[model samples]
Target: MSLSLKRFAVLLLALTPALIAARTEPAATLAPEANQAVTARMVYGLLSDSRYAYAPRQLDAALEEDILRRYIEALDREKLFFVASDIARFEGYAGKLAEAIKGAGLEPAYDIFNVYVQRVGERVAFARGLLDAGFDFTQDDEWRYGREEAPWAADTAELDALWTKSVKNDWLRLKLAGRDDEQIRTTLDKRYANLERRVRELRSDDAFQVFMNAYAGALDPHTSYLNPRAADNFMQAMSLSLEGIGAVLQRQEEYVVIREIVPGGPAGRSGQLQVGDRIAAVGQGRNGAMTDVVGWRIDEVVQLIRGRKGTDVRIEYLPADAGVDAPPRQVVITRDRVRMEEQAAKSKVLEIEDRRIGVIELPTFYLDFEGRRTNAADYASATRDVARILEQFKADGVDGVVMDLRSNGGGSLNEAIELTGLFIEQGPVVQVRDASKRTAVHGDSSGAVAWEGPLAVLVNRASASASEIFAAAIQDYGRGLVIGEQTFGKGTVQTLVDLDRFARNENQRFGQLKVTVQEFFRISGGSTQHRGVVPDISFPVTLDASEYGESTYDNALPYTEIQAVPYQRLGDFSALLPELDARHRARAAEDLEFRWFSEDVAKFRAERARKTVSLNEAERRADRARDEAQREQRQAERRAAGLALDEGAFDDDGLQADERNVVQDVARQKAAEDRPDPLLRESAAILVDAVDLLAADEGRLAARVLRPGRTSTVWAGGADR
Candidate 1:
């Protein structure tokens, strides 16, 4: 229970686990050789449990040492302008860490670089060793680290050379710490004296957990492996209510890169933050001093950014395309409570073909977990509000509705069921099965139908989780038309478990675990695991086609199907497919924006296919030319959307009136045109056809209901149910 250890836990949790993956459960018990202290034992158990699922090969002690040495050397060689004095100060911290680990019988510092204890220590060191041995590490190499061509080697000479260099570096580092060369060398020799004793006292479970953590992190940001203990901790995922900055930050290369900004998040509202912005520093409150964040871990940086709602957080950012020497600017933003209203489905009217088409963009099925626990408004309440909006659109005489679930990651299973119910008349939404094989079916209990009009769902590469389920159900039930890019393929469900739930002391902090428990299947019996929910009609969008979907991920499960349940269809809307397709094609061909998009896709396709890059200066110049062409194409896209053409004007300094004016003009023009979104125009025309068919089919029931003797009494005000 030291201050640093507590800080470590807080910061560690801040680091998001790599993307989801299928993994074997790790051992649950603590290692036999774990430290006697409860906290140390918890750390030891986690490291050895394999629950954290660190990549074993990469996190070996020897590997970590090597990687650490190389990373440190790189930092020094780059001369990031760190003075010699700073090195001494850094070494002082390292010395203290080593001492603490020894006194506590914890193997904290495994390598000279920041790859301290846990699984990363070994993998990074081994990779560095390979590099030092004059081995070629290329894409083709079998090993995760090192050149693909020379992935594995049986000889020890090269590896030995690397270890020798690492040892010399360690010695030199110690010498510079005000220790005489002899004393430094002696200390180094003495450092190994207790190695055997420490190893014997080390817990195997801790080692295993550390291994899992390292391995899992190497994948993408969402995948992870959980041990049984951790799995059990997250039975009821707690929802917290807080205003989020609305930006997705990830560790990319050596920097924390902004992946995407939620359209209405505080960050998104400010319009200063964008995908690919690099955060270099953060300042607290209004007028707080900025703290430099270079070389800091992703989680640590996140901790600094999170605070009480209604507070101001100042961020310093460098644009993605900025040069190494480019200066960054500060953006002071006020954080607010992020609620469903901010991240939920927002409606707009798009006129494409002289028809007013209703466009509802759903960001996520987010239910405030913390609020729900405290009996606050839930996802169902938010969906009800969205339903009200949809009704208003219906009353407004909109042609059709576009339910856009482009980048939604999903939240709240109950909300998913309720939302589905809002679209479809009383039916089962989804089925959930526990580990013991018991099944629970969730249904639409309200019998409330929101809008039964023509519907088109828009999705893309980033859409996943509940997004897939809703889209699949809609497609399976023939309730709507799916358009746009392919959906992200994730059909699995995860349960987050807190390890400390069953352990002693919550603050003892064993950490929490998220484990896959069940897989979702469509009513038609098909699983949206690897294949995802395919759009009925696909659109040519961005180059993300190559960069998205579960198919491109490693260790992804295969798609499967079960026997589909029979549900009577209230009506059919597919009869107008031919007319809809033809109309859409014609509109797209004539629209300048669509034409621009088509051309850009074609030009980028050719460039994206070139995998090899020439090292020659002349050839490099050709590459630059290709890149510039791509940029120009993007610029033209902005103009097509009625945006400002000045590149410098888009910088983080501030927004220009021209930019805002262009955006407003585009929206206003689209509004005035009053064209049904070509996509929805076709949907409306089909719905109108369905209305005709319903009238034709009602020959018997209509006759009976309209009979003078069997007239139904109409109440002035009544509840049908």
Candidate 2:
């Protein structure tokens, strides 16, 4: 049977009785607003429309089960709030979700959420009571950190027992950090109170977003429903500009943790804030009392932090690795707009063994959409900046170039095509496959070639979407050698649909949905979907591919291929692979920095593999002590080796610390900024090897044919050089 017919049959078999019961019985008392009802209907209409990638698939029993599971997981990811009994009760509506969505009957979702809220309240009260009873730190015990895979509690008694251990663990952590009983009590009380307050503040819009996203995510990971506030945030992120500190924040348990520091933002410029740091409190202006924000909603915290361009916002953050008892440091940042300059491509020259290699580090493939539409001459874009940098490199007589796309999450598909155009003459760059299986080829019409010197593209696991497109194109044509880890597999295209567009009333705010509508493919027939653009040369894998990337998503599209498009084979690097590999291996074996990096990756893997941590106070203390000692020893070794040490490496008493010379501080910062990056240096060395290989007789045919500004004619089989 056809897939759609099979789905329809399954839907009828599973949902017929549920739909009948739903119509006969009164709808559960959710008290959903008129706007929310309109929003739900609009979202369902869009998902079912032919414009979406998954529109061909019906809302069958299988999809209903996925939506049900996704909604439950969204509510209690850690299995801490709801019990197995609650899950069983919700499972009754598992096959009925499709019907509910069609009829705009979101009561089942709201009902499940209400139960989760009630459970959270109960758990909070139980946890608060446990704080008064002092924990026995001497007891030998362990606490599982991430309990997402663990089964839910069987009963209230079991849940209380779990909370007892959790509370004890928290107390032990603080106590090990040298916190007194009174201080520990105060902190725990405040944390619990804040959590309760935040939960209470959850609005209907928030619940709608969570539930709708659960439904959308059943189709694809990238598909999501954003509330009004979240929609605004999404728009700001896409524009690469926002009036705030420019740091990505995520809520972890009760703490707001800094996920990334946007380059050129106030927080990025401060040089004090770091990823994984927890924000404890926020203060307005300079003298406003710090408002504890430990359990505040991420959006609320963001609103509190953002202000007028010139206003000051002070943040109290605890360093990632700092002890619980360690006092939080206050950082006052004058808020400003995060501009294009911050996210633009930057270039530098690296002199490696008499080879002057120009390196362009592209943070993101950003473009000033407004400027482009206005036909502004100074329109900022990755392609424009990169072209200018290439011109500079050519004028300076650089031998080779490296395009560093490491940690670039990707942006602007147009920029990716334009950037790729700077290397290859007019040809098919990427192919787009839509919902109906109709394929469209997107080629660069401009035949302009920028600096086509011996090139290398540096990528890591974080390099995704447009980054994958560019890297795949370059590698497909054999124009450049891809280095580092594989790119993040995110080949699907998303189009944001404003829910307000479908609304009948102008004042109604229905938010938006970022729906996945298309998938991209390389000219070489391979799809950079679940399997990303693999580097020609692989590095020591820092991130486990199984735990990260598109492959990690259960519903991610499978890897596929199509007939190869006709294009010129620029050069054959296959002959030089063995020699280059041997050279890199030899150098890596002797490189201290490489050894250190490999060891770090190994340590991280080991740590991630462990499911539980010792809750026993003595064992925990011993672990912390060993970690600290190793860190200090490493710092000492680096200092002894004449390498620059981190500013935090040295310990200093507050006494006379302020007497330090400003000039000396500035010099130290400059030296640290100029410190050599071991990975980039290695990549440059590899490029140098490529240059040498190209100079050899065996590679002469390929090298002579693949010259800068040379255009090849398309032959019957392929392009002829």
User: Whole-model Cα lDDT per candidate?
Assistant: 0.50, 0.75
**What local lDDT does model 1 show for residue 237?**
21
lDDT tens per residue, model 1, 582-684? 6566766875546555765776555444422222334433544565676577578768878544332111111111112233433444464452233343433
Cα lDDT of model 2 by residue, 1-721, tens digit: 0000000000101123453243222222334565777787778888878766444346888888889999999988878788889989999988778877777477888888777777766776677677777887777887765677889889888888877877776667657667788766766655554455456667778788898999889888888999888987766655556678878777654677786677778999989998778899999999999999976778889989887787899999988778657999999999987663656788999887878889999998887676689987766678988999999998998888899999898888888988999888778899988988888888788877886567889999999999999999988887788999987899888877877765655653989888889889999888999889899887888775687898899888888887788877675567767888899889988776676677767876676667566777788777777767776786787788887664433222111111223234334545655654677878888988777655554534445435333522111011111
TM-score of 1: 0.54
Q: Show where candidate 1 strays beyond 4 Å.
A: 1-211, 214-342, 377-385, 436-438, 541-547, 615-721
Among the numbered candidates, top lDDT falls to 2
Each candidate structure's TM-score, on Cα atoms with residue i matched to residue i, is 0.54, 0.78
- Lowest-scoring 10 consecutive residues by lDDT in candidate 1? 1-10
CA lDDT, candidate 2, residue 294: 77
> Candidate 2: which pairs clash?
none
